[model samples]
Target chain A: MKKTSVFGPTTALAAMVANPLAAQDAVGIDDKVNQVFADLTGPFVSLIFAPFPGTSFPWIVMWLVIAATVFTLYFGFVQFRFFKHAVQLVKGDYSDPNDAGEVSHFQALATALSGTVGLGNIAGVAVAVGIGGPGATFWMILAGLLGMASKFTECTLGVKYRNEYEDGTVSGGPMYYISKGFNELGLPGGKILAVVFSIFCILGALGGGNMFQANQAHAQISGIVGDYPGWITGIIFAAVVFAVIVGGIKSIANVTEKVVPFMGILYVGAALVILIVNYDQIGWAFGQIFAGAFTGLGVAGGMVGALIQGFKRAAFSNEAGVGSAAIAHSAVRTKEPITEGFVSLLEPLIDTVVICTMTALVIVISQQMIINPETGSYMLNEAGTAIATVDGNSGVALTSAAFASGISWFPYVLAIAVVLFAFSTMISWSYYGLKAWTYLFGESKTSELVFKVIFCVFIVIGAAASLGPVIDFSDAAIFAMAVVNIFCLYFLMKLVKTELSSYAARLDSGEIKKFTH
Target chain B: MTVKLVVGLDGTETGDRALAFAKDLASKIDASELIAIYVIEWSPFTFQTADENAKRHLRREEEIELATSRIVEPAVSALRKAGFNARGIVRHGDVAETLDKLTVENEGSQIIVGRASADGFTKRMFGSSTQNLVMHASVPVTVVG
Candidate 1:
């Protein structure tokens, strides 16, 4: 029995021999798996999500909601109380040049609006309607209205915590307010938060405010002049931007003061003409917007989806609770912070409510007139869809198409408008970015010159490179700034209240009289 | 050949110092002409009706000129008192741009300007508007802090 146990001894010997080799192979597999995982965890994640967050929910919309809610409650609805006064402020009724600032109230508002009223109104609305349908317009308008309060809160705090230079210059913005306001309130981590906000702001100004602007402007110019190359457009844009920004705030104000209103009126006038031409369809367009908002039409995932898209687009369009505008407004020449704050509220109203609505109406009416054979309904493809075969390009292209439908040679007109909007936006943003850069690096001639050069270079790069991902990340940074800024505003509401009351008392006592100029 | 001396004033401490320096130089050179220039950087008073604010702005300008005159005029008087020739001039724009224009207009004039404060970033970036005149002006420039 011991001798003939068949193959038992042989099998035992084979098993012993194969064990080491099998163990080695197993170890090799484990090592490979770990290497793959590390690669996936590192730059891969950033690359994939870097262009935009890879999430099912709209993070920007969520941030906007949180900002709106916090500011609304903290400021006690100051937007409504000061609506009339905000108009007065814009009219220069309370302008005082001796105040601790540089530019006028009107100039400050123009500067801030130049930041908010750029490609967002042009391409952002188109994106919304394309993805979410006409229903999204309703949600967008609502979000913009709420954004006014947020702007008020942030601008008020900006003035409250501004610093005065010994040479009679002034510096104030989220960088100063977040840290100083919190320090005044005895907050434990205020400085850290303030630094964090400044870092985000600087990145945002460079990416969203600066590069994005140059890119959009270059694209528009290239689109308009078939013979013109993008680099040429970028170079020229950079040169003009360099000249204006090099001169600092005074130059920026001088240029924006003239450019903003002219461009705004021109764009709005064109849209108004289109709207008037399609006057008959206006009622139906409104009906469709209202009806589609609640009971989403043939689109999949219906009402909830439509609402989400609308609010997201509106939030992106006006940048209402985003604290970026407050930085520009903070530089206004006035002792009372509330004066600038009032002017700030008009941004959302103009950018989202007026400009965005016009774009939305044009798209809606145009879509209604162009019937889709497949669905027997107005073509959604023309509005915006990922499908390449769609009737029009998304965002700016869709708006251009809408304009073309109503007027002959309209594409050229829109192309010019796009370039102007983008140009003004870039110039204004350059100042914002420069200030932030100066805040981070010391404010030396070399520092300023260096920032201006880098900024100019990015303008070229933005013109040439694909910005889908870069813009997404920039937009996110901007929203993140809003989150930090609104938090600071919430804590410092008491100071805003005190300033407002004092300003109001001055108005009542006739100490501050309206100026006719 | 008649020698001309031009001094820049903005009513700052530096400007006061520059005026005195220019007066002494004008007297030493026995110059035929002495010009004291003040550049007004746009008046906001035109936008305001308040007398106090307007006076405050005007008084500041006047004080700058008065101080400048007190330094230069006395020197001019001394030059005349000593049987020399002298004159005064004022203009407006950017300080540097105005100075360059003034220097070119009076090509043979020797320019005197205040030295910039090396204390802070603002002063450094702004650079005494006077230093700019020295760098770009066609005439010889002397900086006095």
Candidate 2:
């Protein structure tokens, strides 16, 4: 068995059997950094991921999924109720051109979409379907549907408790409201939860947000060109990211805001084309998904496996329960906080329900995953659920292979898309990490600069390192963010409900002004 | 009767020319108040993270202070040195709309703006604020070259 630093001998052996690259990537931060990250984060990952004695499901995923189910019912399915109003809000039907926040409802939605509409839609979906099989797609869609209420609940509270300064800019998310809302309600633990949330936010920003993006981007780029060391990709990616973020040029940021959406449309449009071309097989693919979800066909762990994979990917994909999007959505320019909440419901609907579903459909319809025609089972390694690839490929490579089936040239486009998604996601997370950093350390210019530099350095670490354990730990850190933020969300949901009712009443009475021109 | 003349600050040669012209007009008019106003073009519709937006809010305040010291304060001081009642206020929004709002809000009698040199695609794209002010201002607008 090929031994890697972070992954134990058992995981390394299994991954090596599934993917040869796990054995081949020799140049990684497998020495000191890997050990340190693992030492610090390993126990937490184990605890958070500890499955029920008889099941393959992790408890943390259950935390988010169950909470989503609860919020979905408690909010009276606000995700469905406000569905049309959310569209109208995005169209600016009720915006008073004179409202006092930093961004329009549309811009806030677009910006927040950019943050979550990254590797999750492309690579994460592949990971889900790779392990869970086509049946997982059904569960994913269901989770995304329920997760919409989770997003609506948190983001509404985001706007209601946002801190609007004298200069017309607003700062918020779960951090502001978690503390403030709980304090108002005379509940204790707001301060502690907020502090823990920020700490996890910074770690998440560094790991899943930064490292994972860089690592995946390196994977895609190196596949096309000859394999180079990951640090080379890391440096170039970090330099460009540093310029857009620290350089503080309006034109550059403006171009990024414009470019990210354009890229998203292009990626989805390509998937749509493939789906259209394979229209006849679409019905058959749905049949397999539904059947596979229930019976799991010959898939390992059967129905339970599909359910777990679907819920996990969908939660991270739209980030509905994670509370990160609340930070971005909180800046919407409207006096009625519920308006932004309505706009935010569209985030998961697009990221998970729309885009992620598209990816799942393409993967399913492409017929790329080798199914033993005789056995009606996905061709996979016996040791693990991973679909075996030529070079032991997984993630984006598997997704790329599926796309390449119909359009031979699409992998090149996907490579470009992956890089763009990675870059934009990094930029978004840099800001998120910085806010949390400044929150913990004083918000001085020097403290912020120190955090920025440290963040840029981790990009290199992520790109260069093939430490599987480090990546796992990073994923755990990110989930930990949801743990803390969602706790606050449960408490502050009452505040959001209050705001929603008031905004609905005002709308019925025609109290809110609409900008016509 | 004292008249209030609002001059839009553009921070260009034309802006300087408009200010000089306004100074002369203020002197010629029997009793007049010349208000030098600089309006920053800001859109709350731009996509930015909460932290960036918060830092940007702080930056705008600093910019307003800097603009007052570097642009408006000198012009106002020059107007005072040239013998006139003058004050400056900096606001943020679409330049034309803000200047128009300032004139109405401050009860100015007339508006004077520099003819922006921007033309071609940029003019079509962004639309010259000077042109908008001339077209939409309720008060009489004097376009200074």
Candidate 3:
């Protein structure tokens, strides 16, 4: 007889306990039923999400953005001051082959450019513009300009700390510079940072340098040569790559030395044709680019947002501060390390300033043609956002469509260009990965063979398989490498300043002859 | 007493130099036999047709015969002219693996290869087959730079 009173406190407590237990059981059943419903719809949920991650601006892009900015500020805008000198160096006006290294300055530039000027410029930029809007393009150019300084610093350091073998071969890049640079600065964690950088370099080279390039090449080849399987494209690519890469650095240098200039000129010529044909839209395009850069018109966000998108895309495209290019530039045949540094700065100009800008113009101008007047979005819809349906495909395909819009059958030419770009990129990256591998394992015949075989095998795998997570992780690893590299570059920048002054002094005097290579 | 020498060459300027080196070496030794071997890697064909297989086989044979006539034969002929008994033979497999097999088959044969400059993919990948043979072969190998 618990008193069941009209208003007893004990009765109320009992009711509360009893009601909650009943509710808890009911809620449990509801949860179970909902889980079953979710299980039935799990695949649908995942399918909708498959493209979302690809669309989002990765945090690694942010890391690159910050690094580019810091380097730009720290270097007092060295990109502008040395812009002329960079061009001069690439022209072999100050090149010296008799210097203690393996490859010429132009060859070094080509090798480094081949690594940076691949699918990342095409597909990566397309993805950035696709999600972040036209505003992203403006920031990309700004970031590219800043990236020059970063490139100058890292490459200068690469050349400075490079290890010259008894046979006159050179080994340099972040793995050597970060550790050795820090050691010179009397830093405590030089060895540890160097080891970590080497590990990241190895991983990055395998993923970003090796597989990503192979994957893109496979895509382009399969796209153009209909009825061909991805694996077939991959196998062919791998074989060609194996043929070239087996020749090692000198072979790579020789091929890139020729391939890079030709491809670069051809690509730029095509873009120039597009821009020239669309000369009428040039005014509006520039207006839109500048406006969208600062004001973010039609975009959901404002100027700051556009800046982020642009910077992220540009950083991803050129990889100016990413330190990967430093590895390629390190093997240049020059006693003056800063000469290669100046040449290295030209990478961002070609990749970001010229190539990426052309892509942005094509995309932006084409959007004007296809956007639906009623929807404030483009005619075609993607992920609930209205965008133009160029070539009935997206990303790199959109770029190809934009090219085809201006020049009929241009896609075929573009496809060939893309394939070559991808192939050369893959070859150069294989060397980068090999260098990192050799650094980790001893430079034995078995070790070299094992790395090449594994690298070639992954080419096929990247071409055939779904590697969303792997690529994402690898892209992150490359940006992390930039973080470590830029950190070292900041401290050892004095070395670069010293080298630049000495080189300039010699140039002023008549001591250093021009075009010696 | 007959001595055997196995020589490997890729169809390059360096490979030609290696053949010449092998011939000169064989001429120095009495009763030395020379075998010139080239390894053909597998390629993807649209369809494995009879014509394709025949073409591949004929090509390999022609390469072997040509090497004997143009490279190995000249070397052997020179060796014979120099008053040493010499013969030329060709075999196909992986450069390193074939060199190993040839060494064992030609029992007590010396292996010779050219010093490959790091200038091409093939040379880079395999190094000098002579260097590989020296490292792993049961017999002595001399790499000519």
* Chain B TM, every candidate: 0.64, 0.94, 0.67
Q: RMSDs, each prediction?
A: 16.6, 5.8, 17.3
* Native A-B interface contacts kept, per candidate: 0.00, 0.39, 0.00
Cα deviation in Å at residue A495, candidate 1? 2.8
Candidate 2 Cα errors over 4 Å, as ranges: A1-29, A164-169, A247-252, A372-393, B1-46, B56-145
Model 1 per-residue lDDT tens digits across residues A295-376: 6554434677677777777776676656667667675656677888888888888988888889889888877234456863
- DockQ-sorted candidate list, best first: 2, 1, 3
Runs off by more than 4 Å, candidate 3:
A1-59, A96-102, A227-229, A247-260, A367-386, A390-392, A501-517, B1-145
**Which ten-residue region of model 2 chain A has the weakest summed lDDT?**
A1-10
Supply candidate 1's per-residue lDDT for A136: 76
Q: What is the DockQ of candidate 3?
A: 0.02
User: CA lDDT, every prediction?
Assistant: 0.65, 0.78, 0.65
Measured against the true two-chain complex, the DockQ scores of the candidates, in the order shown, are 0.04, 0.26, 0.02
Candidate 2 scores a C-alpha RMSD against the true structure in Å of 5.8
Candidate 2 vs candidate 3: the lDDT winner is: 2
User: Candidate 3: lDDT of A58?
Assistant: 48
Ranking by TM-score: 2, 1, 3
Q: Give the per-residue lDDT of model 2 (tens digit) for A1-517.
A: 0001111223223333444675455423265666887788789989877887898888877888888899889878888888988888887677664442335687778778889997788888888888788888899999888888888888888878877767566667777788899999999988788889888888888888898888777776766774666778999988877776666665666677777788889888989999999999999989988997887755667888888888888887887788788888876656677777778888878988899889889888887777887987877765766654444545766778888887899889888887788888888888778767776786677998898888889898888766667777777777888989887888788887788778778878987656563
| Poorest lDDT segment (10 consecutive residues) of candidate 1 chain A | A1-10
A98-204 per-residue lDDT for model 3 (tens digits) = 22122456656766776677666666666656545676787888788878878888888988897766533557788888778788778878778777777777777
